[model samples]
Every structure is written in C-alpha cells, then in structure tokens.
Target chain A: MLSVHRNHPWQAFDKLMRNSMNLGRDLDRMFLNPLTRQRDSFAGWPQFNLWTNDDEIIVTAEVPGLEADQIDVDINNNQLTVSATVEAPELAEGESYQRRERFSGSFERTLRLPFAVDQEKSEARYVDGVLEIRLSKPERDKPRKLSVKAG
Target chain B: MNNSTDLKTTNPPSHELQKQESPTPEGAEPTRETRLYRPHVDILDSADKVTLRVNLPGVNEERTDLTLEKNILTIRGHIDPPHYEGFELVYGEYGVGDFERSFQLTNEIDREGIQASVRNGILTVELPKVKQASKQKITVAAG
Candidate 1:
C-alpha cells in the first residue's frame, strides 16, 4: 500500500501521538460551536466521493478548472490513483490577483477498492469539471446468489 | 545535520493551493432545497479592468447566469446533483449544490464593457473601468 505522507525529519513533531487530547478538544467544541459542524473534514486539495454496489464501484472526483487531457487515471489491482497538474488562471498582461481562494497545483490521490477491478472494462469520463471513474469487479470476486433448497 | 529551525512556522508556504469550503452567509436562513454554496473566487485588478476568476465546478456556460443590478453583480450557477440510483455512497467529503454569490461594484467601473466567459470550470468576468476612474491632476489657480 502506498502512503500519502512523505518522510520528513520532523515527522514525529508533525504527527502528534496524543493520548488524552480528545477529551479537551471535545469539551472545547461543546462550549464553542457544537451546533454547527464545520465543513472542513478532509484537509486535501480536491474532494472525492465513492459509491459501491455488488457489480461495480464508482469513483467521482472534483477536478475543477481542468481539461480532460490534463487528468490522468491509473488502476493497479484494487488501488486506483488520480494525478493532475492544475495551472493558475491565465492573465493577459498586467492583471494581478487581489484575492485568491481557489485550489491549484500538482495533485495526486490513490484509493483502494474492496475488490480487484477488471481494468480492461473500466471506463472514465470528465464532465463539467468532475471526473467519474467506473470500475467493475472481477468475475470471481463478484457476489453470487445461492439458491435456497426446499426439502 | 540541520539543527536550528523556526518552530513557529510548521509548513512553509508553497505554491500549492488548497480548497476551502464555501462560507455560509450570515444572518440568513439556510435553504431546505438544494444545497447552496458561495464558490471560491479570485479578484484580479489591472490598470483598466478588474477581473474575477470564480471556481464553480460542475457548472458550464449554459447553466451560469451573471447579472448586474445597480451596483451589485450577481453570479448564479445551477448544478445537477449526481444520480445515486442503485448505488450506495460509501464515502463523501462534500455535498453537491448550486453556487450563488454577489459582489458590489464601484461607480468607476465601465458597466458597458463588462464581459464574462467560462472555460473548463472557471468563470472569468472582466469589469472595465471608466475614463474618470484613473488618477487626475487638479490645477490650482491663485487668486
């Protein structure tokens, strides 16, 4: 399995292995803003959604402001990876950004499916800045119904 | 052997940008219909024009509408949610919704020359400035 976290000199400092910190955080949140849950769930660039069924698994990702050719998708067994190079918005001559809150840059993410996928039968489409990849489960891994015997 | 380092600065600023969730409007009732979001944006200023680069994914030119009323410029983008029939959503970090936001324009803007276009998933709106918007030197007459 590939890892998103890279090796750093101060990895221990970055990833704090706290034991009893959840109680303090929960207490702080209960007093501060407990009613409204913050939307800041994943601290990543783009967001993705995953759907699964008996036969197929669907993966949809938000790749805003990118062309179809600019995005690359690869699947190795059950692991799927998506990578893209997102460029900054084009400016004609003297225009400079006064305020910017959009995501852009080289992005790569890999997700694992429950079962190995049939790579040959997989299909992907980029529509309205959203990339959707559909992967079908191999015949052996697919669930088969066992008929009930009536004696 | 790197020893001395600034402890305050954990992650040094890089060129990579991160996505922020749309901010909920203050003092407004949350809509019960389709989810609404204020898309992230970038405001660019030039000598003669101010441009706005809006991040509106899942929206195309046909579904986007821009209008100027008085001094406020409104951008409304309609998006259709992905169909989840016969499928179970195992994981979701964000929800799909429409994008709607308004920006107040200054009087110096040349409203006539304002133009907008959409490419990929970004919307670019150019608001040109009027002649009087530039700096002018006033002459003083000694009486």
Candidate 2:
C-alpha cells in the first residue's frame, strides 16, 4: 500500500525557515552526511511496510538477492533503522548489459515508534528475499484488560 | 561479439503513455486493469547466448509464468501482498502487485534452447543463439 506523506501543511514552511537560519552550517553537515551515512527520504529503495499492533510492531522490506550478512538492523531510543546494500553481479569479459534498470546501492531507512519496544526480544527472519522484523512492545507498554465489579 | 547487433531496452507503457497511444475502449473497467506494473529487467546479449535478469521480489516458481509463442516471449509473475493483523500502516514505499513483461524474439535467438530459473526472487532467463547464425564464417579469397 502506498500513502502520501501526512506532513502538516506548515511543516515545509517551518523547515524552510529553520534551514535558512542555519544555511552555512547545514551545508557543511550535508557534505559530511553523505560521507558517513546516506538516509532515505521517506520513500527509498527496497520499499518497506511498517505495521503496528497492541503488542508488537512489524517491519518488512523487499530486498531480493541480498544475503543475511549484508543487512544490518538496529533500534535505539525508540527509532528502528535498517540498512543494506544491493550489489550488482560482476559481468564476465566480452559481456555487456543491454538493459540496466535494477538498482545497486546502499540504503538506510529509520523510523520512530510511538511506544517503547524491547529490542532484545525482537525477532527477524528473511524468507524468499523479504526481511521481516518483529519488534515486541515493552511489558509496561502492553494494554491491560480491566475487570469491572458489579455496580 | 558483433558491435553492430542492435540492443535495445523497451520500457513498458505508463498510464499517461498508454492514454496517449490510444483511447480506452468503451465499457472497459479502468480499476480492474489499472494496476499493470512493469518489472525491472536487464538483458545481456553475448556472442553465443542472451541472458536476462528480472527483479521479482516475493515471486516463486509456483506463481510465475514464462512462455514463448510465435517469437514473442512473455514473463508474468504474481507477488502475494503482505498483511499484518490489526496493524495500521505507518509508512509504505512500494505497492504489492503483479508484474508482466514481454519481448519480441529475433531470428538470431535459438527459440528451442531457452531456459529459466528463479533464486532469491531474481529470475534469470537464458536464450541461446542459433547455431547456424553464430557458426557462419565468411571466407576471404586472395586476389
């Protein structure tokens, strides 16, 4: 399912104002950002889905032809990040590509969760080129069923 | 390898392009067939064979169809949509849909020797060159 970004109408203007104030500093940061880590702009490669429930949050990404060791997933301060690279296979001598559309590059996506999660308890599995990560909500975050006494 | 052999990448028609090409027929259901997506494909033609690699995540052997008839080769594959119980989507980048691509085979291809396989959601199709065409050698006479 694809959705339009639900950003507040004023958010863009707000960002513009802030960016103008720190233009020089931001330029330096931008130059350094790509050297260290490249971040996705909401919609990026190997598109993923984020799901939330009462007990857990699930994130799934479609990354075909990638080995498990190539992917790195981490969560810190309620933000989950997934990073991976899709490398194009080396071609043999005298072999040239006729059609090249598949992407081959590194990508990183990060999202903040509404509730705290137990990172240690989370489980991840890659099946048929899809990576699914299940992040369980902390014990304190789980909803409690309340019992009512006869009134 | 002959550098003169023409190699072209054909792009599938987008909605706007399709609309420009021809008018939609009357009583045609737009919603039913609006989801036609073109899978990214790469084709490599060597002296002896042509190799095609298509990115088809979540597609397996059971859900894919490959056929060649009358010099038209077609690839059709379906990917099962992922569903989460009681889950509201927070962010999504790609939509889950079926993919279809077709190619017009040339006379140089050995239609009988086509082979296909799927691994890690990557489909590789091999089309061998016709022996007679690749083996033809022009002899130069000394005057």
Best by DockQ: 1
TM-score of chain B of each: 0.74, 0.69
- What's the distance in Å from true for residue A41, model 1? 19
| lDDT agreement with native, every candidate | 0.74, 0.69
TM-score winner: 1
* C-alpha DockQ for predicted model 2: 0.27
Q: Model 2's CAPRI class?
A: acceptable
Q: Which regions of candidate 2 deviate over 4 angstroms?
A: A1-43, A145-151, B1-34, B132-143
TM-score, B chain, candidate 2? 0.69
Error of 2 at A145 (Å): 5.1
Q: Candidate 2 lDDT, tens digit per residue, B1-143?
A: 43212111112222221111123346864344324457777677677888998877778888789988899998877766777768988877556666777889899898889999987778899999888656769899999
Model 1, span A9-100: residue lDDT tens: 45554455343455434443342232332222123657778999888999998778898998889999999988887665554566555665
User: What are the per-residue Cα lDDT tens digits for candidate 2 across A1-151?
Assistant: 1122254666767778988857644432333232333322222465668888777888887787787788899988488888887665555555556655665556677778767789888988887677898999878778888899999
